[model samples]
Target: MISKKYLIVIVGPTAIGKTSKAIEVAQNYNCEILSCDSRQFYKEMSIGTAVPSKEELSAVKHHFIHNKSIGDKYTVGDFERDAIQKLDLLYATSDFAVMVGGSGLYVEAVLFGMDEFPEIDPSIRVEIQNNYQNLGITYLQENLQKLDADQFEVIEKGNPQRLMRALEVCLQTGKPYSSFLTKNTKKRNFIPIIIGLEADRSLIYERINRRVDIMIEDGLLAEVKSLQNFKEINALQTVGYKELFAFLTDEYSWDFAVETIKRNTRRYAKRQLTWFKKNEYTKWFNYNESSKTIFDYIDSKKTETEI
Candidate 1:
């Protein structure tokens, strides 16, 4: 019966209407939804992360939404284990479940077990952090660029934590961070069918800008302000919160912070698309495509095994 189980993954860039599609698919299959969005895991981040509306959540059972606090250090590996356990329970009674989010790395972890890497001394990470704090991110960025040009080009250089992680790995292993990535796929009980929603780049940019405006209207500034003390948290170092934090520190004008948020969000969406596109298994759909079309595709994939 494990072969009969299907994990429907609804993936796309931010503001691509993945939430709506995920809910619709879960309802059709009479299944629960497991969220893979990294930001939505933190309960403190709701409006900025665009968590599902109460009515939408009440309409269908959603798991992993606001399930962790900002203070919790939840990694993608942790999420993969947690998700598998939850999926096992869901599969006990149903043949299908929906997983949805724009975080491609987290999505990939759930689909294929995370790539294993050499264990490095904690002191290497500490040294990198110390250098980053004293010498600035530029120092870490330059070091990574020299150590592993391939990863430097693709990794999000703006995130110091990610940069430090890559640098420390390279220094400790004396190898490019990219060299550790494994292509071997992990076995899972359920079949994963990835559905990606896409739109014209210009249209996506417009939608992102509009969504940022909506978040501002939804009291994102106040939410960011309340978490000012926690700005050092890795979770808050992200787009909306980072830009707002800059404003709170008198580093930028209010208008400039809002604009920066929109700009950064657009960039993040681009990175998400790049990551998802690498997976050849993902089927693409237009953002406005009807639920009936998606349902038909899902039905086609659902086949009976000869007993």
Candidate 2:
């Protein structure tokens, strides 16, 4: 009989050391790492997205990091297809693989499959965009909260793209955008061993603030300046870049932008923990837990499956 393959998924909020943990696990299993962080997929977004360091990338052969240009139209569906294909190839030689990221939606796409939404009219989306441009993101946020408070609670509140998409779906269907997300999940061949790293809320916030400061020191401003022309792109509409772009555009002072980045990052980390904790099967470890402890837990899980 063929032994079952395992996909070890390491997840946590930003700045929680998920990358280092993933590298250690991959080295132990002699397998490659596949990144599910949607922000890390772009070639032009290293400092702001906190793409793995050069040493970290070299320590473990990583897939999907810096694999696409900001100009590319990649979606969760594309990542799910690409990641599964890569996992299939990896499993041909090894019984284990690692996937690590903070992007919960993308991780869900790879694990259970993307949620199916009804086809929405293009005109509704266009109308929403026009209103967003004229009335701003506040309009979208208020409407989504009114239409679907459940979705409003979970979504990245600062993401205009997600906000607009949800709003358009709600308008087009005369129903909450989240109602369509209840479809049955798709099955996969490999069993998933999910490990989550966490810390006290105060500690997580401190780390996020320190990391943002380090990004600035690492020339995040220069990186954002280089991508200023593409500021309107969906990928650039994220936290760090968006705040800095506002500074560049004279909409915010430099000090205010930096502070906003830290504040927004803390909020993003909170949302990440909320999303990952919903999975009852996730084996969570403290942020400072030793790798040996985690490895032993993973081994025990694998053994149980075999038995």
Most accurate candidate by TM-score? 2
TM accuracy, model 2: 0.98
RMSD vs true structure, all candidates:
1.9, 1.1
lDDT of 1 by residue, 8-67 (tens): 999999999999999999999999999999999999999999999999999899999999
Evaluate residue 20 in candidate 1 and report its C-alpha lDDT on the 0 to 100 scale: 91
Best by lDDT: 2
What C-alpha root-mean-square deviation, in Å, does candidate 2 show against the real structure? 1.1
The regions of model 1 sitting more than 4 angstroms off are: 1-3, 304-307
For residues 157-204, write the lDDT of model 2, one tens digit per residue.
Answer: 889999998999899889998777626689898999999999999999
* Candidate lDDT (C-alpha), each: 0.89, 0.93
Model 2, poorest ten-residue lDDT window?
A: 177-186
